[model samples]
Target: MGDNNLLSIPPTFLDEVPGLADALADEPLNRVAASFPAASLPWALLAQQARTHGNYVNAYAYARTGYHRGLDALRRHGWKGQGPIPWSHEPNRGFLLSLFELGKAAELIGEADEVDRVHTFLTDSDPSVIDAILADEAAHAPGTETIVIRGIN
Candidate 1:
């Protein structure tokens, strides 16, 4: 008889979405989302955009869609519900980004339980991802001016 080990789940690496990069580079985020509804990256970007515009409800909706789509992709790629979704993988960033956006939107919308759940999920997947995502976002922020302080003359 074979032993069933529930503690040894393998890591999941999702396949690349066809033309996703091209569409993201060339099209508006809305159009990109419409073109690639199955891919999590566009939806994640949409959620981030909505959040930036203070549309918390829209952000939540988009992030939710991305989260579910990511879950589907994870299942399709042999993820048995629990594994390290590493942040170092480029293709995995969409799902991780979606989770981050979901948690942020959930917090803004007062979905405290959802926020907590997402936090737990992200940490469980890979504790380093949250900081990685935040750092990436900070690096890409628009009009990010540097401030220098000196003693008053």
Candidate 2:
């Protein structure tokens, strides 16, 4: 029910969580996650952190939570289960990041079907998102002080 055409479903843009940026900058990740459990970004960050530390199961759990939260947001914004959840949109990044992290975690944990499904979902959402995310991570490798959300520095 969005900007759907014959060939494609419309892109979905999630609404921003109020005060999230300030909270992310000022508080710890755990605290932020606890405070805004419905927001995907904090959970995505938690998943990334867990994955970085080699906690695959924890990463999977966190990413799954973020992904579900993102789905709820998408539905609320009129996404009909299939549509472009573009990486170019700042608010969509959390969900895309969660999906990506979930794929990685699924791979590490030997969830072959989950990995394939995630890959397909991501490709369907935005074909360039994977490469874009990889490039962003490469540009902002570990040890950086700033937390990046796609273009957000």
Candidate 3:
């Protein structure tokens, strides 16, 4: 849904609507849902875990909601690091692939604004998001930070 359409849907209705995607995400998302804990973790966090372990199924599952659908999240996921992805598992690749999907989806949907958003978010020559990713990546684990990147609207 577009942002306005999303808002148009009543909160109760949105919540009550069953997410068929959740069925696909249930296992791994459940595993890393709580950021090394055992319960109540958000889907975005689990998406991060999916990228970490290269569990593409679960990562794509989780992306249907939350910041995973945001341009900033795409930028973080796909940005090519100055060095290799901090962990052996390469989520950056998935993130990069996901960005391509977003780009194509924007084109198919005629959302040029969204295309710009994803473009500026991911592939810009400027180095801010990349720097932040470098500063924040963890070794042998997925990054769990929800950054507030500025100036990429």
Candidate 4:
């Protein structure tokens, strides 16, 4: 498994969702599904996990949640989306990473509108954002492993 951990997610949020514990105890796919109910780091993790397991439906759900939450986080930080996300915002990394995930998820789920929206945002934002997220993923893992965000429309 990849070691791309996100920032700490609030325990309260996870606790509020029913069946979280049960889902965690179930098979891997269930755990990923459990993550879909939360609008936080878990969504991003779930998106990646589901995609890895070839569960495109769940991946799309989780990725969309992650993308929306990321956008909300940016909005909270006063991001107008006119340029690259500001470096000072706490969720900058998460938001940028979510865009990559969302783009791929949209493509997998055949959501052309979402793909176009994400692509427009990426085109407007700094190209280096994706590289930074990938670098962080590599840094957290052993050896030269990389996380590839492919076919971002």
The TM-scores, one per candidate, come to 0.88, 0.87, 0.30, 0.57
The per-residue C-alpha lDDT of model 4 at residue 126 equals: 49
lDDT of 2 by residue, 27-110 (tens): 999999999998999999999899999999999999999999999989899988887888998999999999999999999999
lDDT of each: 0.87, 0.89, 0.40, 0.59
lDDT of 2 at 40: 94
Candidate 2 stretches greater than 4 Å from native: 1-6, 143-153
Q: Pick the candidate with the highest lDDT.
A: 2
Supply the global lDDT for candidate 4.
0.59
Better of 1 and 3 by TM-score: 1
Q: Output the lDDT of residue 104, model 3.
A: 40
Question: Candidate 1 lDDT, tens digit per residue, 100-131?
Answer: 99999999999999888888888878779999
User: Each candidate's root-mean-square deviation in Å?
Assistant: 5.2, 7.7, 16.6, 11.3
Candidates, ranked, TM-score: 1, 2, 4, 3
Model 3 pairs in collision: 33-41
- In model 2, the Cα lDDT at residue 138 comes to 89
Instruction: Summarize candidate 4's per-residue lDDT along 62-152 as a digit string, tens digits.
Output: 7777778766655655555454553234335445556777887889889898888776675455445556656776776656445555796
The pairs that clash in candidate 1 are none
| TM-score result, candidate 4 | 0.57
Q: Which ten residues in a row have the lowest lDDT in candidate 3?
A: 8-17
Worst 10 residues of 4 by lDDT: 6-15
